[model samples]
Target chain A: MSTTTLQRPATPSAVHLTFGRVVASEWRKLFSLRSTWWTLGLAVLLQVGMAAILGAAARAVAASGQGTLPVDGVQAASAGLQFSQLAIVALAVLTITAEYSSGQIRVTLAAVPRRTPVLLAKALVLTGVVLVTAVVSSALSVGALALVAGEHISFALPGAESARILAGAPLYLVGIAVLSLGVGALMRHTAGAIAALMGFLLVIENVFAAIPWKPLQIISPWLPGTAGSRLMSTDADIAAAQAVPHHVGAVLGAWQGYGVLVAWAVLALVAAVLVLRSRDA
Target chain B: MIEAHGLSKVYGTTRAVDDISFTVRPGIVTGFLGPNGAGKSTTMRMIMGLDRPTSGTVTVNGKPYVEHRAPLTQVGALLEAKAVHPGRTARQHLRVVGATHGLGARRVDEVLEMTGLGPVADKRVKGFSLGMGQRLGIAVALLGDPSTLILDEPVNGLDPEGVIWVRDLVRYLAGQGRTVFLSSHLMAEMAQTADHVIVIGRGRILADAPMATLLAGPGQEASRARAPRATELAAVLRSQGLTVTQTGADTLEIVAGTPAVAEAALAAGIAVHELAPVRASLEDAYLALTADEVEYHSGVGAPANPEVAR
Candidate 1:
């Protein structure tokens, strides 16, 4: 009798796709989809185009000597960040929401049974992609604004103020991404999540701020969008003038502002984890 | 080997999969049989750890599926008709999953070739036919070359050739000492491919036995009869320990173990007209097992029912 041996190729262990490998895989998934690219492209276009146009307008106003160059060049350059934040939020929500829409989340969960790891991997990938884009976009917007405005925009590069705002913009976008991801996980529906996120950022917080109450104003700075917008502004004078009594030092200091953003992010992430763990895929 | 111990799943107030338990072994294709709402898909999902069981547990290779270090390498499954993202190309989709386990692009291409999907490897899944999508699903299942496979309704939309191909592929896999568990509502398909069957209905196990044993089981009625005048064969066979029913004026149906008894009766005094064994088909076995448990019964009488004909 003759015995035959079968040859099998080596199979990698599942843990080989550690949290890091899962993050990389998620990054590939996020970027390969047409929706991700389209949204990211729109974010860049809106950021850079709005910055250039605003820079031109700001130069005209400054040249006429009617208005002071509002803040620093980096702050003005990143003017698009305000509007572009919506695009990043949409991208982040869609990162997980698309799976629910297409019924692919089940497959994803099956591949990685530890639910928290899958959610964390998605957040990590989203943060990485959005942060890099936000940083590059902010820098280009500032540089373009300086060149087109044709004014020696005395923006401190690598200086404390410049570094703070520069670092804060990406951090702001990251916070928005996490906030939107939490909303997405809670809602589990793309339209519902996006609508709820937009409403909370654009309407509800502002309405609460409008109430004739000091406590509302004090707490308003900690809301996701409000905290993010506060972190993006570079004019210390304007920031100070608008700051509430107790909010003066806490809201004006760079690290303090970053801390507010992180607080909102952590709260949203915790909520997202709870919803994801409790809900059915 | 894979085992399910009192597995149950509930969605709201409805129990999708009741407490069902069965074992799937190696070196054979075990057909997971059920009717259309019989919880076959839900059970398969629970086994794969896609859906958490409400009560019991399912283990693969003597461990919970989630506890396995390499789940895909331990058990590969194609849970649905098509689970790929529509935007991704076949190769890209496979590569994304492959990368998770540190498997390179080469393995993706290899599985693509094995599934005969290399020709359309670069095409977006949105444009692929149902058959192509099924093939893609199978490709992913084979990506890890696992020791066990669980494919749910894998032959749903295949052509005859594709059907034959899948049957061969599953049988071949089982022949190689791998355990193959497949679910299908089509009894003919199971009959052609499976060596053993685990029949389910109303989220409960109906039967779990070897194919041959199921065929020869006692609950099913088999017929044989013979007489000089075929019309009188029914009466004579009924005189013996057989229940002879009439098919036509000249033909009779006798529920018995063998035709030799009918032959003996004919040789004694009566002339033999015909003596043949009436074997129960796979469909008969399945319907007999699940007849009482079928949800939404049509309320229509069987065509063979004498009262219904009248």
Candidate 2:
């Protein structure tokens, strides 16, 4: 064995491209920007801060024996999602669009010429980062609000319900990030993609909801914002249902909402991959 | 070695890079020369696999760039200066690009030092001046120590010292048996650095030969005749089909060798007191070769193509 080893060359024959290294490279690129830190920090703060504020408002109403119902731990912890999704999605969009706007995509493509893997790695990296941050932000908001609104907030939900809601909130956030990354890749422009994303999330679905058309209402329920929120709603709706049974029927069930979101994310990624592979940087 | 065969790129109605073929050999720098919009960048992009050719193929070391096991080791290209995110520090930018090819921190640091960017390596690129940005682009290109370097206008925006540094770097790389292909509109830079030149205009190759051979091709000799009857000498030289222009009261510039002009003067019984040869510069040769293909003509002088002008 020693003699045979001595006859072999000292170095490996070739170094092929590796997905793991590409993902790591993508991670480096994602974190290197100041905007990334600013955007993500704002997302976490918005999530945690809004959650506490809403929890305090709910606590006050409950203490006064007012008309509004008391807020649950899950809902209070996730109150920031309403504001934070904008930051999270915007961060995700900027991750890819920044490269395009600055013409760094050419350098990036020159380095990793296969093209599709780069986009895949970018989406995966964005998902992982957004997931971790979303989980941390969700946990802090819920845990902190639960501590502050002790008597008014109910921790009476089952372990499975609590776990599902807590875990589902981050997953929902991940879906939003991945979907936005796809949109960024597709548009390859920052302001334009962000505008399109906000228009779809803020205007189209809500506008359709008020259209008074039954088929249009069907489209509204499946919109990304509505379906994404439902990932949290399925379990949270159960807690709300316990207090007022009428609220339970208003949401898309947990898996169904996740299914819609996952479908949008998958389809968007598929389209992004196709476009990115075919087009010049 | 980089080899391109019938490579072409068509953007909409414009054939940015029409069917063209050339080979860049190792051990010397090959300069790519073209006027603005002459498809030098497009051809370079196709060679690097950054732009897909509308037809034909280009290969580096007998394989397409994307098909190579380690492409960064095969060729290093600087397609644009500062093709980096403005927010990323130069060090971070190099590290990320280096990571794609499994290059380590040591290699990144070495290139930064090589490009003289060590002082500003940690500064965000947004604060970098154009010269510093060009240096960073070179640093990124040199990361993997690739055998072939394709730089498009690498010295652009560089100060005199920076320009000299890049000239030495490419020459040193080529002297080590690497293939160095670069493009520049600066003919003086090309004349000094390139061992061979492939000139293109309007998406077509106008000349491809050794640097000396291209400079020696045509318009390499002109003669100045100082004669009392300079106007008569100019008329006689023009009748012989040589372009002769009067410079001063007693001098005529003949687009021919001194010996030929002296013989003509002697035949015409014109006493020539001074006959000196004027060497043709590379700029003259380049202009003569690309005279008809220039996209935008100034229209200040005689029409380049009188038929079209009419």
Looking at chain B only, the TM-scores across the models are: 0.88, 0.89
TM-score of 1: 0.87
**For this target, which candidate reaches the highest TM-score against the unseen true structure?**
2
RMSD to truth, every model: 6.1, 5.2
lDDT, model 1: 0.77
Please identify model 2 stretches exceeding 4 Å from their true place.
Answer: A1-16, A234-251, B226-242, B248-251, B264-274, B302-310
What TM-score would each prediction reach against the true structure?
Answer: 0.87, 0.91
DockQ of 2: 0.55
Residue B274, model 2: lDDT of 95
Q: Where in model 1 is the C-alpha error above 4 Å?
A: A1-16, A62-71, A152-158, A211-218, A235-239, A242-254, A277-279, B224-274, B302-310
- Candidate with best lDDT: 2
The residue pairs that clash in candidate 1, if any, are B223-B254, B228-B271
Against the true structure, candidate 2 reaches a TM-score of: 0.91
Tens-digit lDDT track for model 2 on B200-283? 988999999999998888764788889999989898888899989899999988889998998888899989989998866667
Query: Compared with the true structure, what per-residue lDDT tens digits does model 1 show for residues A42-108?
Result: 8877888877887787777878888755556777767777678889889988888888886667767
Worst 10 residues of 2 chain B by lDDT: B301-310
